[model samples]
Target: MAFEGGERGTTDERLTARLRTGVGERLGTSDEHDTLVGVLFCLPNLVAFSIFLLGPVLYAFYISFHEWNILANEGTWIGIQNYVAVLQPAPWANDWAPLTDPTANTFWYSLKTTVVYAIGTVPLQIYGGLAVALMLDKRVRGKKVYRAAFFMPMMLSGAASAVMWRWFLAADGIINSLLPSFLEHNWAGDPGTALMGVMLMAVWGGIGGNMIFFLAGLQNIPEELYEAARIDGATGWHRFRHVTWPNLGNTNFFVIVMAIISAFQVFGIALVFSQGGPYYATTTTVLLVYQRAFEEGAMGYGAAMAFLLFCLIFAFSYYQYKNRDQAEVGY
Candidate 1:
């Protein structure tokens, strides 16, 4: 019995040693070293993202529950009052009919304006971009120059573009100079035309980048498909409808989602041109947040509004992702 016990102990010790060897071989190899090196390389980006992006977001969320004022440099605990104020109808607005008081109802009015702005700009940007991309895809002389000209507006800083458009869209600016006398009016100074002016600038600024995406999509389509369509006597319109549009489903989806998000977050154009408007016509959520935070010194309120806008953008993106996935599956 003593001999047998000693033998069992020896076997157990050998097994333990083998297990340790296996673990060491797995964790202390060149692959492990490579992993370690990769982690070290990623550390700086992780740290930078945490410090510059995630940290600020978390801090803003924390401050959203407090009444924060930049001038005071201190915050008082408000316990979601800012959020409540942002969500609820304004005191001067009709509680049962908030839309009736655009001037006083801050959140709803801004949301409405944002939706309108998105509607006004996104489709035009997409269609205009697609049109330009299709034209550029053809064998044309000086194609590079045409592409550069179209893309020039996007290269300019948003502030610079805004400033330039402001000058051009002024009552007596270049646009008015060419228009008939009956059509001329204060483009940026009138509420009815202000949002349209902003939309025009947005469409012009965004088209070039969006066109690049479409051009890439166009290039990816197999040329043989077009040849087949031509052999079947398909017209240009039919070819675009059946061949091009079908192939560009993913690209179209991406452009639409991006355009919606960008339009929702529009600020610089409104800032330099309309300043939220002659009557808050071009006031986007971001513009409203800027006004609340910097212009009004209501940091907490601004943060709350920003969080809400983030939620909206997140929801839209998620919805689009789900729809796109389902669509791809169907296709």
Candidate 2:
């Protein structure tokens, strides 16, 4: 009986030791198991974004508060001087002679121009696109051909399309040639017409793309909704009012957001056609940034302009999103 009891004690000790060893083995490898998977999952993307997108964005912000040629001059940190130079609402601030010196007023003018561009172009794109989309939503004859024609400008590269538009708006070009000699004027070289020309071109470039999105949204509205509306004596306009507009909430939101963003960063077309020309009549904030940094080699100041534009766009986008979300919730 005593030997049996001693044997039982040894057995219990051995079982406990084995259990501890097993648990310890798992615990030792547990960190490796978790960490290995994490590294494997996130390693590639983390490195890529840090090197490419995130790195440049961070670097741009750092460059914003400095005075430097940046690349060749090795920037000096002037702190908020750059911001002050940009946000001041003084009349004499736009003296762009000191290309390196971005005054608060010059920045304000650029901001004003950007706001005007956004206000003008976004509504044109959104409303015009929606109208075109409504026109094209039916089973009309040769609809595909009409759709392709409308979308052609959007399909072309911005530089190429802008060049085409510039030529068309130039004196003695297609637009003026079609008109009588009395009406002929160099649209791209006249301050009165240059900005308007650019805005028209922008609507042409953007409306089709917005229309495509709206078309998709229209198609997504369940046909049964329209059928139900018609049964309730909701004829043509009424059907559209009850079934179409309300159903288009999401599409309208997308188009407005995209249009505003595109309008704010409208640089490529400006570069190709206007170059902010006709005596700075068409110079946008982004174009001004390019002129400062790359053209004038005031890289630090140019980076500052870019940062300011980014902040404006961020604020605008946030406002639009919040407003749209509230509207949808109200619906």
Candidate 3:
């Protein structure tokens, strides 16, 4: 019996070794070799991310603490002066507030412009997108063609779209031709109308893409809810309020967050519309950053301003996320 047990133990040991070899052969690697192969596969993407994305982000933050001269490719250590200069509402404070004084800082003024631009455009995009999407959700004639027409502008490159809109909004363009003589002021030139023109372009250009998203969300909502609401004598608006709107919470949240982020990062419109102004009226944060970093060669200040804009976007997004989650939980 003892001799038989010893032979069985040896056989079992041989079987375990064979299984290990079989696995290694099938995978073309041992366990340690497999780990090395996995790492090798990931290495290229890691290297590219570090080089193209991560490196620049970290470098920007580092440069934000210094005085950077892109022309000289040099950065002097300036501590937090760039941040202070960008963030401080008043460059010189005391008895007189810059708000009422003529010597108000351009940085603060541009920041306020950016805030207003964001506030104006985001809601327009959200509500306009929803309205169009709801209309399109019904079985309308020429649905595909209409959808394509609306979405075409979103597919165009920013420069191309801006150029197209510039022509349309030109002094003697189609829009002016269609409008009455008294109403046809220089849309992109007058400070009073420049920002409004850009905002209108932004809303029109953005709505189609957002509408598609909302359309998808609307389709995903169960039809039974609408049917049940109808059975209970709910009116069109009542059905929409209780069923459609509630079901669209997630979609609304996504659209709102993206809209806010895009609005805050507006540069192309401001650049092409008024070139950041008919007296700096349409200058956005991104346009200001571009002017500072590239045109003015104040890289540090631009980086600081860019970072501040990022913070504002992040905070708003966080607030939206928290509220969305709470609403979902309550529901």
Top TM-score prediction, candidate number: 1
Off by over 4 Å in 3: 1-50, 89-103, 327-331
How do the residues 176-251 of candidate 3 rate in per-residue lDDT, one tens digit apiece?
Answer: 9999888887787777777787887888889898999999999988787888889999999999998899888888
Q: After superposition, how far is residue 56 of candidate 3 from its true place, in Å?
A: 1.0
**Model 1: residue 137 alpha-carbon error in angstroms:** 0.6
Per residue, candidate 2 scores C-alpha lDDT tens digits across 60-91 of: 88888788764675788898887776655454
What does the lDDT read for residue 180 in candidate 3? Answer: 88
lDDT of 1 by residue, 212-233 (tens): 9999999988888889899999
| Candidates' C-alpha lDDT | 0.87, 0.80, 0.83
Measured against the true structure, the TM-scores of the candidates, in listed sequence, are 0.83, 0.80, 0.81
Model 1 residue pairs with clashes: none
What's the CA error at residue 267 for candidate 1, in Å? 0.5
Model 3 worst lDDT run, 10 consecutive residues: 94-103
Q: Can you list the residue pairs that collide in candidate 2?
A: 85-103, 85-104, 86-104, 88-104
Q: Model 2, stretches more than 4 Å misplaced? A: 1-47, 90-104, 326-331
Which sections of candidate 1 miss by over 4 Å? Answer: 1-41, 90-97, 325-331
lDDT score for residue 86 of model 3: 80
The candidate, 1 or 3, that scores higher on lDDT is 1
